[model samples]
Target: MEIRLAQRVQALTPSSTLAITAKAKELKSKGYDVIGLGAGEPDFNTPQHIIDAASASMNEGQTKYTPSAGLPALIKEIITKFKSDQGIDYSPNEVVVQNGAKHALYTLFQVILDEGDEVIIPTPYWVSYPEQVKLADGVPVFVEGSEENEFKITPKQLLDATTNRTKAVIINSPSNPTGMLYSEEELLELGKICLEKNILIVSDEIYEKLVYGEHKHVSIAQLSPELKEQTIIINGVSKSHSMTGWRIGYAAGNQSVIEAMTNLSSHSTSNPTTTAQFGAIAAYAGSQQPVDEMREAFEERLNIIYNQLIDIPGFTCVKPQGAFYLYPNVKEAAKLTGYKDVDSFVEALLEEAMVAVVPGSGFGTPENIRLSYATSLDLLEKAIKRMHDFVESKMKA
Candidate 1:
């Protein structure tokens, strides 16, 4: 039987990060010693307190479906979290919980966009943004972010990209692939342009709690009350609380937009996982010591690995201030080693060195590759040593 799938399904690109991780797992299952540096989540377990909360909720018979938006108690906690962390106040009615931050983004695009609406996404974006926008039948317009700018686009760039059909702009500070962050001053400048143009802002701050050193995470919505009205903040416990598998995330924005997202979610996901919502409540309302410890660990790993990564022949990288990924430009390495492109370099690295890393082409930068440091320092050291030996051998060849 011939099956006809939707054209949109045919147009979608499978997530490259997941594909590489799965390949590494397959090789490991075959008794190969594959060191995977492609993961997006933390290596640590979910804090015992949060896990206990979920268990307690289940024991107390709280496993039933929640309100479409979320349990009211969890929504209140989200509101309080925004006020305390970002200095932005949100009422319970202005927040909606979803399956994950990824789903929060998908629901936002669905509620806000119409056919032909353009969303200006800065390049080297999280892999899912453009795909999710396309799923909503919206057009994604890209603005290239040069390595010189630490992969962040400027206010002028934003201004030049704006069109009458532009409906929104996405800002993912402490960005996924690059791990670079936008300063408060930078965000305020961009916010002014969006205000004048009436463009809605979608701020993906899922990595807000993962910053290192003196660098701080600032929500664009916190820049001012006016900008707050124009911005929708996407975040979840997936990264911050190490609850990736629990799938609890929420969106805070204008009341009308929140209502629309809630309505859409009702007909689609119904509600976020009920026990997970209870766990998320404890995550936000309880102690934050575990989050702090994980941040420190990531910082230590970054400090240990960054110098080693840059010391490799023909490799260059911008030191990331937040998140756990290092995006190093390997174009010179590819050229020096006789590979056709970064993708080929990545493929050969996996096959020959038994190391897994994601190519930058998937993240809209073909000159680089992303290495996740979410694993142990020992594994990281092993992976980098293998990579260095592989590149050195190619150079000698």
Candidate 2:
């Protein structure tokens, strides 16, 4: 029997990052030594205090369904977090909790976008942005952020891209694939244009706490009252607290939009898991020392591997300011190694060198590949050596 899939999903591209990760796992199961750098998750477990809080909630019989918007107590914690972290205030009614940060974004698009509405997604974006916008019957308008500019779109570019159909522009910092962050001056400039055009700013700040060196995270919503009114912030404990498996993320913005998202969520997911919500509450309210420790470890690993990665022949990379991924342009390496393109180079890397990396075409750029340094420092060093040895041998051949 043949079943027809929906047209909405027919043109949808599967996530390239996940596809390679799955392939690596398959080879590992078959006794091949495969090192996967395809996933962006933290290698750490959930903080013990958070786990204890979740267990305590269950023991105290707080496991029933929560409000569609979220638990009132959890909402309070989110509000407090915004005030402390960004000095931006969000009232209780202005937030909606969902399954994950990804779901938070999906729900926002569903509520705000009508058919044919356009969202300006900067290039080298998270893989799901375009697909989510399209699933909501919206058009994705792309503006390329070249490597020279650190992959951040300028305000002039934002202004030029503005059209009557432009409903929102996503600002992801520290970005997923690129790890670039927009500074205060940069965000202010872009915020002014968004204000002028009356376009919403969808700020994805999931990696806000993962910044390194002198780089700092500045949320566009914190720029001004008008900008705050115009921006919808999407964040969660997945990256910040290592609670990916717990699945708690939320959105904070305009009352009407949040209420709409909350209503839609009621019909869709009912509400996020009650126990997970409690865990998220603890994640925000508990001592943040563990988050700091994890960030420090990632920074150390990044410093060690960035040097090794660039030492490979025909490879050049921009040091990331935040997040755990390293995106290096490998076009010259591909050419020198005799592969037709970066995609094929990546496939050969996995099949032969036993290292899995995400080709940049998945993020709308084909000259580079993404590698995550979320694993131990030893594994990262070994993986880079494997990649270097592979490229050198291929060049010699």
lDDT digits (tens) for residues 170-220 of candidate 1: 999889999999999999999999999999999999999999999999999
The sequence of per-residue lDDT tens digits that candidate 2 reaches over residues 1-397 is: 9999998899899999889989999999999989889878999999999999999999999978899999999999999999999999999999999999999999999999999999999999899999999999999999999899999899888989889999999999999999989999999999999998999999999999999999899999998999999999999999999999899999999999999999999999999999999999999999999999999999999999999999999899989999999999999999999999999999999999999999999999999999999998998899999999999998888
**What are the lDDT figures for the candidates, one per model?**
0.95, 0.95
Q: Pick out the ten consecutive residues of candidate 1 with the lowest summed lDDT.
A: 79-88
In candidate 1, residue 16 scores what lDDT? 90
Per-model TM values vs. the true structure? 0.99, 0.99
Question: Root-mean-square deviation of each candidate, in angstroms?
Answer: 0.7, 0.7
